[model samples]
Target: MSQYKINVTKLNLWYKDFQALKDINLSIKSNLITAIIGPSGCGKSTLLRTFNRMNDLIEGVRIKGEVLIDGENILDSKIDLLSLRKKVGMVFQRPNPFALSIFENIAFSLRIQGIKDKKKIETFVEKSLKSVFLWDELKDKLKSSALSLSLEQKQRLCIARTLVTMPEVILMDEPCSSLDPLATLKIEELLQYLKKDYTIVIVTHNMQQASRVSDETGFMLLGELIEFGPTKEIFTNPKDKRTEDYISGRFG
Candidate 1:
């Protein structure tokens, strides 16, 4: 039997009176990349946030159904959000590194979790940077300001920061959107390397990106999941006409 890292069962959400998600159901496999693709306002980001309860930061947001992580319901009142976020880190559409040094940005997350060993932080910082293929370029410059790096480096740094926490699942909301073609390809390569150890769920606007990076793909339209299956199957032999139309560039 396949082990699921995340299972969304009849998940629904509302931002005040406006319904954002309608009965979303998905099984995110362990150590694989699951891509969410859709047009604007299609509830892709909202659904991603549900895994770590990021949507709760917004006022008037309501949720129904359950998001199960490792068989534990994340929506329950007793869930520890801080611990949950540490286990399920998120990278936003744009790279938003802190003004601190690259090393500090990665180490800060560890410190906030109450880690105080200097040698451990240093060792893990190098490991995390190397994990994302950023160590050779940024290793000697660990003291440099994170804001000084280019867009791609910053994105990788953001990813490295998340990885330093040793999260079980990484949630990315259009993580490559702010990068150029070469940079985007690099991030995609990093994702391929990452999936060997961690489950990754990405929300992407680019169809090519979804097909290239995902093991499974889910298509959403107007707050509903239109079709979902293997990446090739979803892109090629979509069972739903709506999915076919969107995949073929007819309408999104």
Candidate 2:
């Protein structure tokens, strides 16, 4: 199998008449964390959504070019969106847990997929929570409402919810923006652990978080990918002046 998990070639996006992404091209490696960093309105989140065709939810959105996941073109009109999303799960900027019990939230995906076996669902839920390091903390409180958990736990639960689907790729959009510093650190650690099994693509405004967690980094500006390389090189020896300026606090 190829080491690269996702390949984007000449990708472009537009919302009605307003173009949101310019020709974006990059290869995301499997079992690694790739971070997309840019200022606000630079199309970070917009580009992230394209992976699972989340942009389709918005009207008048047009896209051109190819996004290949495991050698399959996901942009094809005939592509099964449900299957695509199942393979590429997403964690949003905020922790949006279901208004259900902690155990129910984790089992929801399996239930919807026609998994009616109670024992099977229970096993999957336990495994999912354990993967996110939440099994011990919430094991005794499985019946409690998910909303009753703290913000950090909610975020971890959101991640655990994604894991139940057994996705190959996980996309995060500013997942730590609403979290405190300690909570953010915990999520970063979780990302590190997750990348051992799943490919991770994160859109983050926090440069430090990006530097700390991501193996590869892409710096976007005005919808264009200005520079992409190893995280260390991108931060310390950027090839593009714009990237250097942005990194040095000259301008976002």
Question: Candidate 1 — which pairs collide?
Answer: none
Error of 2 at 214 (Å): 0.4
Please write out the lDDT profile of model 1 over residues 1-252, one tens digit for every residue. Answer: 258999888998999999999999989999999999999999999999999999999999999999899999999999999889989999999999999999999999889878899999999999999999999998899998999999999999999999987899999999999899999999999999999999999999899999999999999999999888999999989999998888899977
Model 2 poorest ten-residue lDDT run: 243-252
Task: Output the lDDT of residue 71, model 2.
Answer: 98
Give the top-scoring candidate (lDDT): 2
TM-score (all chains, Cα) for each model: 0.98, 0.99
CA lDDT, candidate 1, residue 177: 94
lDDT of 2 by residue, 129-245 (tens): 999999999999999999999999999999999999999999999999999999999999999899999999999989999999999999999899999999999999999999999
